[model samples]
Target: MALPPVLELVAPHDARPPQEHPCATGVLPIRRISVSIVSLVLLALAAGFGGGLLGAWMRATPPAAESTPPAAVEDTQTRIRAAVDRVLPNIVLIVAETATGQSLGSGVVVSQSGNIATAAHVIRGATRIEVVLANGDRRPARLVGEDSPFSDVAVLAVAPQGLRQVAFGASAALRPGDIVLAIGADRGLYGAGGAATMGIISATDRILPRSGVNLEDLLQIDAAINSGDSGGALVNLSGEFVGMITSVIRDEGSERSAVVGVGFAQSSDSLRPVVAELIRAGRYPRPRIGIERPDEQHVEITADVANQRRLPVPNGALIVAPAPNSPAVRAGIVAGDIVLGVNGAKVDFDFPMVNLLKRLPRGSRVDLAVLRGGRTLTVSMTAEDQ
Candidate 1:
């Protein structure tokens, strides 16, 4: 018996044998198959091109975004460095010798005439003052004038030769977050040179009570204030002097603690007038009310007396004693009277009578609202220079 017809599989490209009889008349559709294969090849090529283009676009786009930030950072750093360099020469290390000891501080040259601005407390009670320049030149300095009791500012005079003056900037234009540089001899007492620390203006128009006087219109900063940094220059990014380093507040618990980023600078706007006056005269002209409170205890006693008398305002600047034949006596403000206000502005703990008198010009007429014997009386008076 003949074996059953065996089935054989053939590749698509392989030719079929002519001896085949059944269904050989039907030819394979080669053209359609070739067209489908061509279409698939083109599609694969298009997909490859699209993927390469997407990769190139992604690489190019991210590079620009990544590079821009670093470039800006570098530019800013360069600017700050340049600013520090430009202003460094104007900064001087001050040494004051008194009967007590030698004290080191910092100052900024403000004029070609060898005028230097520094904190008054630095040179307080100084018998002989010397200024060490950036190039290590030591020059003798004389006390020109000072406003230490009220503003803690001072001016010194030296030889005009070999001094670089700093450009002054308006402190009123400064806002919070403005970049500032503090340049001083942080360790100058130990013979270190001038160093710079960077920070931003944390606040403006701040008032701080210091040594029985209120430091008003202060620029609060977050910069580090070292031991010898008082009387140093606080400059803007443009290398212009904006403020003078006055004091630093430290944390106190059991003993003295190192508090970082809490410092105060006297604004240049406030200093300008004081410095001008100091330069013109030997001291800042202060307006006087010719009455004394002596201390806080005395003020409190006067307030208590006012309350007992049922005065309209129970708290104010209480006069412990009035000067004989002075403005207070002329205005009929006796020792028992309490000054309530001046020129419609209330005088209290925040706005004290002393601060008001300081702001008033000499010979300026002011209305003092006084409380006496349970009555509110307004008295007109003229401020006298003290």
Candidate 2:
């Protein structure tokens, strides 16, 4: 079987944590992040240390009536500095110990009551998980829950120590040219503290295939996301987190896995509801249609794919198998069947099969337009609960 596109996460192959060493144990004085000169002035202004330059600063500033906000008073460079400082304390390194090896990644604290969000793959097969805060504080984390495999999000819990949480911003309002920061742990091999790099939101609404499912509605950036940067924060200029750094699309032509200014993050707009459900009920009740898409099947039915596969339509989800005794199996959605629509709506790249299923209300009858042997059949079935 052919493999999917290389959307690589912080895997054990690229970097592995020590077998017995706990995260951030006895690490003295982590390296300081280098700040731009503009940022230093912004920091000084915030700390009231710029009082001596008050005349110069006020002369350079616009009238309060015309200013947008505090962020508007400063330039992008200085605002980025202040934003990085505001969120730096919330970034943490995560260590997930599995039977074979360990997965090392970064995480962002989402609540002062100790709710942390990280990449689902970071803790997928973890037997034990530990989090090291940016201040060199180590805390044991308990897996609260995870979003469905279609979205790469997971939540963890720790003792409530008044941790500063990153504020969630509206990712829907972001544009392609907006400035964003990718915050992660340091690269000293120990992976203890926080660091960040600058970039712009290159694009949005991207999709990447992983395992047998597709991670949809992703935010694409040209940020320098690297190994150990998984589950890190992708924050906007105002220090509000808009997405979570998840994976990097590597250069296929290179001999080694190389990041070529392409990275992907799960948008906060899509994951906010999932996070709420997880925190409320310990899990997100993702609609279970029990679909088993054939490995490496293209989500979109292109013109060439339509002609090559000899399908009547151009786009739909191709299901190769339905799980035994599940709703799909009971509904007669069999192998070699292509899902054309759900609830009288077309299923295509814009509104994918997963998105369709996710929109279906639980306990409501789901009418699926199944393409079997080139004949369309409306199969009615209720989706299963979590």
Candidate 3:
């Protein structure tokens, strides 16, 4: 075998009388160095070309898709738009002249037969009523009936043809974080026609106070419901009406602001039966109970034991006194019993008895469970309509 390749550095020096060199007989060859240098250059060129090919391959490849599917995003958008379109035509702008000037609100078309549902406050003491259609047609409207002080819904009759009516949804099944579409006039700022806003259900079963009545079963939404958006449709993704946008939270941020988006609606569940009653009788039926509470959710009690007078129980709506002609007194219910439950359900403090009365049918007897001292007693009483 040939010797391994040698690496050598040459040095220049003054030449002494040169000794006879046997290396001349073994002189180094230049061809070997040239071949080595050429091999190294070729190796570098091949490595450079390989690196360039790898970079090109990476650049040509496509990027991976987003984690969220495109179809899901599109579907949500489609549903939201469709819900708005279906409810917008049914949303009517209610204009009334208050003591100040013009007041604005929203209303939903409940009858293609020309009846519209709105907040009672919108038409309170109004001399003229106008129904503005989504097609820009304004027609004269008349207040046929209203359920005030107990409910805020009012029915208006108009002569316009082809008015669309919104389909109602079950408000009892509504849960928080559900998407809802709100459609109404931006106080007519979006022109004579209506505008639509999209949001989610923020809360439910809320109690709100109206000027004329106590509104119950309120729905909280993030939709931009304004002063003029009252009586408008709060529709779900299925395009079914759920509630009416009655009021917006202002100071407490319950109303929609640029910073906080909060809106409240009177649930259609509370208004539907009332509206039907108003339409039929010109007044909504009020359910009556014998007990009165100083505060909501608590019942008052006072009792006598074996001809001995007992102390009065405070902090509850007492059954101490019953109506002279009331159902409780007629059903043989005695004073001094604390009402804890109605119809087998616990009573709430705020409008507790009122809620049970509304739900129970007239002339139907409900079992009221009472707490007397440490024992519980169930009293059966026939409920009455007021």
Candidate 4:
């Protein structure tokens, strides 16, 4: 981008080049000088680029990306290395031998019991499935299940072995600028299966509707996600898997359709339900509990809110109202009641009722800890279909 022209001194009588400025102020249209380096400095002619390198560098609003300090960059490298070392063992190359050709991609073990989470399109219409572990050990895998095309997530099952489950990081807490690493096999099930690339989250809650695929609540990242990167782990600096790399944006402007450029991931926060249901029921369901949570505040449990309500807990979903003849109403829950837990899982600002509902199957029973008038009570109800 071009920089705006620098403000120059104008002669009182007529405009002349800055080099001809008469050491006297009488021939000038004055602008505020931030600093006079020296009285002699102003007395000399302002030689444009030849002698004003410092002034050019100090120009306001230069089109420069934010730069990281050397020390901070070194620290980031250290963190990336630690995250990769911890997560690499969980990333595996999935080779789905379809009737047409071999479909290769990456997959992350979601459970210690040998359930793997990968992109549904990666293993679509497979005749035989094979999982190549990080150490190059091959294991026969079976098609466990897949979610809706909108989710693009599939689950595979193999015999239980010594495998690591990725520590899931809360995507609900992710910010746009958070540093992340994309670990996957980019066109190299033989060599690139464990490759890692680092980038920042470009955006969150992105919706992409293109070419018959409609996905929602995606994490758009600036990382390189190539052909085989689908279903790979998107790890945070904390060495936690925060997202699953799903699709790459490659328009006609792409370098031969290679989209290692901009990519999207299904947020782990949004995956808890999809992954859980695919493992249990082989599909995703729109589960509803008929309780409305107030969407007013990002942080619902501020110190001020806690003090004002005189609530016993620091974090919870304050029930605005329960739908009439709904599960919450049937469970005796009402407005002014705070839901503190879901089936023994604490309900905080981070893991609120919304996420809890998504993680539960539609027909599952719910145990909620409700705080009403300073007393905690237990309530139970079956989750009805939405």
Candidate 5:
């Protein structure tokens, strides 16, 4: 038994103590368990909050059908067409034949008694005139009278039976940016009638320069005006005639190119006074002032009983040159005398010649105050009509 030497056995407690269960008390294990529970709770709350936010977003947005409404629309074409229908019957296409053929323009029936108004250049030197109605009836027209080359306006007469007269509107009150519509025979051809255009009044009181006459009181607009639109009506949206389309503008040397948005019209004011005179008189008499140009500065002198000082001048127009048998000469006014006054008022070389001439009536006597060399003198003279 001693030979085996006996296997020695260690006690459980004394043997290399069993390796401790290392994971049981370490920080890593407890931390991991706590993290797992927290992650599950966080995910549940996140899901609930996301669902609430999405529901709120959907509730706040408006539906497409509830946001948009039906709109009320208007027919502009119907209104313009109605205006044209009411006005076209009152418009006429004017044709005037000259040696070079015919000039085309437009006119309006201004009177139930057959009077028509148009631009003078349209009917200038016309051998004959023709007027065409909207219904295609053409008739011979007569130029009753014209007020030119002072004003480029003329009056024509058409048969009154079937003519439709347009109602005149007040052009004096028109302001800038007011919408205007114009109608005219855009082309020169007969039965072509008129076309309608729309724009606004751009300016007023424009001065137009032409041969022989200074055209004033012009109505400027931006409507499209063509060659044959002269004398056509520029009407308001209310369908009333506001002005007459009379001219179109183009740049110099550009003949074939039609311009855009520029036109002018003769105002109804200028037409009224002109038309009234035409209806009254067969012609407008040109006004004139009677006077003759003096070759040298002339002085007039006259004698006054009231002159106590020995002044050289009193009264009378003195001529520096002997006007042969003229009123100044016949009035005993000699050369080298100073003209002090006419009709009791003093006159001198510094006085306006126009005013002196204006003050002296033709076939009237003028008293002049004058000074000759050293002697004051007064003279009575009769003015001669020029």
Candidate 6:
């Protein structure tokens, strides 16, 4: 039998048929072989490039440092040191000897002509006064003028020639949180090489009440102020004097207790005009109303007395008595009348009648709102010099 007819092997459907080459028998063309070699090289290159990219993406990066540069820290220290150097020369230690004992304080040179600004209480009732300069030279000082009755400021005269005076900055430009340096003698122990305490202003336009005194519009700060630090300089970062350290608030729990970081300063803006007047005329020209209210109790009586008299409001400046031939008498203000305002501004504990009059010019004509016999009336008066 044909026995499966010699069982011819069949090629699969997907198999490619072999073609005859045009070149010499059994050898491929040179162009086709070159293309095949180039294709293989390209495939190898692509694979190598992909593997290298993947490896680079999986690698970890180094972290950055968080330390500050040493040079920047040093620059800040240099600036603060420069500011202290510029103002240290103007500070002075004041010593006043009275009949009872000696008092110590601090002061700042305000003029090249030997004018100095200090606290009035420092030189009060002094038989002799001395000032020690930054170079340890002690000089005799004399009271030029003082405004202790109303303000705690005072001016003194010394014999310093060609002395460096402090550069004053505008206190009106100061705000809460402004950095300040309080420079003063340490309990008058150190010479003019005073100590410095730094702090920020806690409040502005603060009113501090004292027995028989009114400290209005004060600058409150947290600087360390000792007893001798009164009248010391409160300076800005630019080496300009902005305020005068007046007093430190002690803890009221006990008379012997001390409180740290609570002090007050008088604004230099208010001191400038007073110092100028003291230098020129030996006294500050303040307006007076010629009415006396000795204490807070007397001032507070306006409220009670107004209720008894059935007045419009209870809070005002109650007149105890008007001086004979004074401005209050000339304006028809009697003891029974109450001053409600000055120049349309209300009279309160902050802006008391005396404080309002002190702000007016000596020859200013002020309109006062008075409550008399349950009627609010306007009274005009001219301010007089104190």
Better of 1 and 4 by TM-score: 1
Q: What is the C-alpha RMSD of each candidate to the true structure, in Å?
A: 17.1, 20.8, 16.8, 14.5, 26.1, 21.1
What ranges in model 4 sit over 4 Å off? 1-71, 189-193, 252-260, 286-386
Backbone clashes in model 3: 17
Per-residue alpha-carbon lDDT of candidate 1 for residues 203-267, written as tens digits (9 for 90 to 100): 99999875224778899999888888888999998888899998888775634356655989999
lDDT of 2 by residue, 1-386 (tens): 35678886767675866576344665433333234555777887877865757878889987777546766656777989999998888888898999999998888888777998989988988999998888778889999998755578899998869589899999999999999999987532664578899899998998886643578879999988889888999999899999999988777675564557699998989878887788778888767777723343323565677799787888887775577888888988777788888899988766677777777777777889888875789998888767
**Candidate 6: tens digits of C-alpha lDDT, residues 1-386:** 12356565987788888876678676778899999899999989998998888778667544567677889778756766777888888888999999999999999999999998999989988999999887778899999998755788999999977569999999888889988889887665743478888888999888776643468768999987887988899988888899999988878676555665589999989888888899999987766656633342224335565678665665677776677787878878887677788887887756666667667867899888888777899999787765
Over 79-152, each residue of candidate 4 has an lDDT whose tens digit, in order, gives: 88999999988999999999999998999999998999999889988999999888778899998888643467
Query: Model 1's lDDT to the true fold?
Result: 0.81
In candidate 1, stretches whose alpha carbon ends up further than 4 angstroms from where it belongs are 1-68, 98-102, 252-259, 289-346, 366-381
Q: lDDT of all predictions, in order shown?
A: 0.81, 0.81, 0.72, 0.79, 0.69, 0.80
State every prediction's TM-score relative to the real structure: 0.67, 0.66, 0.58, 0.57, 0.54, 0.65
As for candidate 6, its clashing pairs are none
Model 3, 92-114: lDDT tens digits are 77777656677777778897778
**Cα distance off (Å), candidate 3, residue 118:** 0.7
Give per-candidate clash totals.
Answer: 0, 0, 17, 0, 33, 0
Ten residues in sequence with the least summed lDDT for candidate 3:
298-307
TM-score of 6: 0.65
- What's the residue-level lDDT of 302 in candidate 1? 38
**Which ranges of candidate 6 are over 4 A from the true structure?**
1-69, 148-150, 190-192, 212-214, 252-260, 290-347, 366-381
- Span of ten consecutive residues with least summed lDDT in model 4: 292-301
Question: Residue 262's C-alpha lDDT in candidate 1?
Answer: 92
Better of 3 and 5 by lDDT: 3
Model 5 error, position 253 (Å): 4.8
